[model samples]
Target: MCDGYVQCNIVALPEAYAADFARFCALNPKPCPIIGQSNPGETNVPLLGDFDIRTDCPKYQLFVDGSPTAELQDIRDYWQEDWVFFGLGCSFSFEDALLQAGIPLRHIEQDRNVAMYNTNIACQSAGPFSGNMVVSMRPLSVAHTIRSIQICSRFPAVHGAPIHFGNPKDIGIDDINKPDYGDKVEIREGEIPVFWACGVTPQQALRAAKIPCAITHAPGHMLVTDLRNAELATL
Candidate 1:
């Protein structure tokens, strides 16, 4: 019910595949920082709050053998006894911090989701999990860029800091307006595009793994937890 708190990206898979997924997150902490995880068959994550994993999130993406099969509002029907849910810190937490520090976010200003792209940067493979890094972009002035880095560095759990800034092509992003995921926002003449490791890394891994069945939060529609955004700050 709270919108001000940090919202997390969710990933649920069978116990048979959970270990590999955990390793994948460990190998790619920037995009897959694990904030909370549930025991096999349990939907509750004691660390985040008292909430049902199947029903708490607003949206879910169902993948069958690695391909996205459907988008559902609730995943009650897809629940399995061996399923383990992982809660990954999302960029939304740091976005809040940035806004509070007067660092304007073009995506929010334009009423659109932050632009995200699949970068050529390869992630360390863990078992069957392997994929290119994915990043979210925000256009900011040179001054705000430095301030954002300082502010976001305090929240490591939610993707600590900007990974790349300035020329999008440096990260293999061919076009500023064309994003692999999420909506595109404006980039003013003086503003440089800043990129952050995104929570969508697991989703990309899921596609690469092609497991029989996997579930993840739909891009942008995150799990709103009881944990406050301020609580995520390590500094």
Candidate 2:
């Protein structure tokens, strides 16, 4: 609900996997841009804000051996001493730019979480982190879609621009109305579905890697930081 400020996706990994996970983000920056990260056993990332990693986010998803096991409100008791946290730039940051540009977003207008889908696009593997890319879709008019590309391109740290538009089949998305994550919003008659690389991609990579334990922010639930969106914009 905090607008204008930067929003991030959380990925907490054990010390053993931290280096590889960081490499994974560097290799697949479109979906896993790292804005802030903490050292192993550290709860605070001074670059983001004054907050505790264990309790900052509204919700957390617990994964055991790549399978989601539970949803948690707080992770204090579950925190591991050797785990490192990475804050990946989220699509929510660029949504503000679109709204400000006078481009209406379907999911925001419908008051539903943006539609997200798993795509056939393969991510570059780093260590064991390898999987197809996940994307968030926004249905917009052709004119607005072009403008969105220009506006979002300035914020590369927040997924940059639409990776694909028009045909869902081209992206391995068979059904436009049935998304793999988040609620489906109706694509109006004149508008086409535009997809952006999503932060949730890490979760898919985590599943492929089959890490013993991984913690991530639940879909649609993000960590709000004090950094402003404008601070991340390119000239």
Candidate 3:
């Protein structure tokens, strides 16, 4: 649903670990900004939309003891009474804004997902959650890059602004053409890779935490919420 509304990354876990996960997002707001959450055993996030968390998103990744075990279309079978769901603001919101402003997104133009990489930058630890930050990249000309920064800065909930631009090596990314997640889009002669804090940061933390069971949105397949992208902007 690449429409005018914003989409979100989903993280669902047992209520026992919910506080730790909440703290993780609080400590690292850049990458894990929480927009809404559901109470234990509840599948609805009224603040986002009238929908069931179990089947709203296009796809989900199931993790067992920190390892991704399966990818599924619906997670109804795995739902538990103690499950708490977190709806996180995703880069898709700001990407929509960038596209509206006429800033070219190579990934979209190339019919591919935005390139993402695990960064050497460490996130503030909170209980069982701690890992290197992950970022999504888009290639843009210098002029468009500046405009994108200005445009994105208004949406802090959805990872506002580029955290890094130009050198991929500075952020521990060895190859511009190779990404740790998502497909690689071409960076043209006058274009540079602009990186934004990505929602995948929590998945990295999940890997480190190794919780017994957890569910997260599959990369790039976000929950389409009724909330408009404009509603998330501060200015």
Candidate 4:
């Protein structure tokens, strides 16, 4: 597991809303492609095999009143009997695809989190879950940009294609250097910032609903699933 490995983005919510959220992901495959789910009262994700929703994630974010209150290493103590787990595709799975194909990412080299932003774009709501899309950014040359589009288009399980690129302000981001989440990287000369539908988009939806309580993997600390990235392709 060098540079190219499938990384999973995960979330766990009340079983009460799991079904609707699952259905919503089905309805909106591009933004939310759910790879696995766990039943109520279950701490393990069977689909992911040997995965513990509470401890598998390297970092956890506890949300109260729709806002993050603390970042923890594990959430076993807060686990609820009604909780359900969800595993979604992350852009990290495709980072290997990009690098193997010869694209260079500044943040990865710098060992930083991918820059994320809240866009003016609105997602189709499910029940009370709705909000503007959140996206992760990577800067690349024009040639690599087109090449990445072709490469990432094959992995629809993750955020499939670029929603927007170029000037960040157009996407409601005032400063590309100051990301709403994660650390920003240098945008090389002649390179434009590319945006992808982040798995974090679902968290935005969760916050908009103002759920009583919820938990999610820290932005970059995702679940390492049993399913391989190659197995996620439709073709």
- Cα lDDT, all candidates: 0.90, 0.92, 0.92, 0.81
CA lDDT for candidate 1: 0.90
Q: Model 4: per-residue lDDT, tens digit, 1-235?
A: 3234456777788888888778767776767888777789788766666767788788988888789889989988888898987888888777777877889988989998889888887777788788788889999888888999988888888878777889888978888888888997899789999998888888887787777888988876777766677766665
- Residue-by-residue lDDT tens digits, candidate 2, 1-235: 8778998899998999999999999999999999999999999899999999999998999988999999999899878999999999998889998898899998898898989999999999999899999999999999999999999999999999889999999989999889999998998889989999998899999998899988999877789999999888996
Q: Return the clash pairs for model 4, or none.
A: none
Worst 10 residues of 4 by lDDT: 1-10
Q: Residue-wise lDDT of candidate 1 within 23-70, one digit each (tens)?
A: 999988999999998889999987898899999889999999999989
User: Once superposed on the true structure, which residue ranges of model 4 sit more than 4 Å away at CA?
Assistant: 1-5
Report the Cα lDDT for candidate 3. Answer: 0.92
Measured with C-alpha atoms, the lDDT of residue 22 in candidate 4 is 83
RMSD of each: 1.1, 1.0, 1.1, 2.0
Where does model 1 exceed 4 Å of error?
A: none
